[model samples]
Target: MDLGLRGKVALITGGSKGIGLATAISLSHEGAKLAICARNLEQLEEAAAKITDLTKGEVIFVQADVSSEEDCKRAVEQTFERFGRLDILVNNAGTSAAKPFEQVGTEAWRQDLELKLFGAIHCSSYAIPFMRQAGGGSIVNITTSSAKTPPASSLPTSVSRAAGLALTNAMSKDLAADQIRVNTVCIGLIRSDQIEKSWQRLAPELTWDEFAKDPRHDIPLGRIGNTEEAANVITFLSSEAASYVTGTSINIDGGKGAAL
Candidate 1:
């Protein structure tokens, strides 16, 4: 029953909502001190409050745009300042700028990479040394199934996120010597505010519930996914339970990926 996370420290990016928020609470429940960051102050505050209420573990929030180096640095710096050590890093902050191939341009692609790929890069850059010094740690990147499936609508985001999987795998081998484990969760369609927004942007006519119905039938699980399911799996990997696992990408999509 013990995850051995009691009193340990974790830093989660994009922790204001959805999977990130859920992971924060789950980690807290296992007794990890948490530092979560997002660009929106209000959303971050609300999410932080909810996590604190749910887990009662030490939770702190800071405002940071993951796309910016200064902000990324500041987030990790603030986390270290507050926790005095970093045992886990969850890079869950990402955005997809979708468009038809011809319609997409350099800037859009750049932004997508900045948010999804480079954000992971920057956070990992700062998280590693402390983790090494503190006697190793875990890093979980919440990537998308888009990397595998490439949903027609989500363009550059898919490309960058796919790259993130590569990042996770590659880092796993490199960081293994330091005793730092790196793994990734390849996400499927999850019911969340971001999904709602994506739907509105791609197909404004249908309400979110209506939009969700079509996919539920196609996915073998007979339903989509939620924050809790994703968080639970990540919590397992984040714990000592997955001590031998690293550089592996687990597709938590209820058999949707279908790829070996």
Candidate 2:
């Protein structure tokens, strides 16, 4: 069951909370040194503390916005400087307003694309060098299932994530030649702060526990996914476990994609 990830290094975007935080903890527990980034220094520092408690792995937090080219470049550089190598890059940062297409403003759409899509692009551009230099590595992009199965009215974020899928597909071949594997992990309603806020806003009458059950009841398996579940898949994609898997999008959504 060992993923052979010991001594490896990773950089995760939006590592301050949710899936990103869980992935950081998971990989660290798997014995990987880590560097994670988020715009919120406080949250990033807190996440670093929790991961340090769990894995006792070398952890550093960089305060940066993934959408900015400068921040992405510095993040990769900081990882190399802190860990001396980069073995994995998890493009997990994203944001959206969950508004209808016509109702969504131009600025909101631009911001969503900038953070979710361009952020991945910027990170990949910088991280590729270290992966190339190290002779090989892995990149696991955290896109949403909405990209594949856009729920009734979530066009802006869906389109952005679709672009991410294309990017992940396109990078696989060229990167694989350098021993860098690239894959996309599509998410459903994994437990996170966003989901919590959504619950309060969308179903305020329901208790937290009751709200948690809503999505589970809706999905075939009758439950939403947890961060650990998603993180496990990410580590698999990053490690020797997924040696032959590349350019493939793995849905960690418990079969709620609606594509079948």
Candidate 3:
């Protein structure tokens, strides 16, 4: 079914790889003009090329670290300047910080919160104007399932993601009058590039398949998720089909989270 997203403009943060890259490709498949940003120019170029190959759609890559307020502003501005208007903003730029509470230093806590929470805040602040200019739009913030059911050693990420969830709910109510819908997608163990790196460093003996199947948690599905799965949900949330979906934090974790 058509998502009615043709010609719409979307800006995705941390779009050079992993879930962000997957979302960019998914949006492009729906015929949306894309502006993807990341800190590394080389990776951005590679992702842009892959997106073009997949969707044959218009895609631009900008070098920007979402943790910096200035970079966030510039990224949004450049997107509007290139596309003329923004219809969707996917705040997916973040990392997984899962150190023990006692082990997490003050600097680590500050860095994680700065990158995950403030990144979305800064991007949404700048993108709202363009969305309003376009008459209305959607914002999908990529959080984690830990926000709802945080486990031991889930510090920094869980705390920051909880704040992100609150942000989503609050903005959904506040921005309703402007026709700007805000929502979040909570993730589980997905097969991202970052996960691949972790496997290489921590379990080099195991192959990708073996690594994903290693019973780390009692995931009901008995396996990890994929980038495309998460991206599909995000793309749906950003589309007209999800017009009524706001302030809700949906888990794409295959029933791994205990929260109802």
Top of the candidates by lDDT: 3
Question: In every candidate, how many clashes are there?
Answer: 0, 2, 0
TM-score of every prediction relative to native:
0.92, 0.95, 0.96
Model 1 error, position 170 (Å) = 0.9
Across 105-154, the per-residue lDDT of candidate 3 in tens digits comes to: 99999899889999999999999999999999999999999999889999
Candidate 1 lDDT tens digits, 1-260? 88888888999999998899999999999999999999999999999889878877789999999999889899999999998999999999976466777788989888888998999999999889899989999999988877877867778877998899899999999999999999999988787887777678877897766776666448887666788999998998898988999999888877788564
Considering only N, C-alpha and C atoms within 3 Å, which residue pairs clash in candidate 1?
Answer: none
Better candidate by lDDT, 1 or 2: 2
Better of 1 and 3 by lDDT: 3
Candidate 1: regions farther than 4 A off: 197-217
Q: Sorted on lDDT, highest at the top, how do the candidates line up?
A: 3, 2, 1
Model 1 — which ten-residue stretch has the worst lDDT? 208-217
- In candidate 1, clashing pairs total 0
Pairs that clash in candidate 2: 216-222, 216-223
Poorly placed runs, candidate 3 (over 4 Å): 201-203
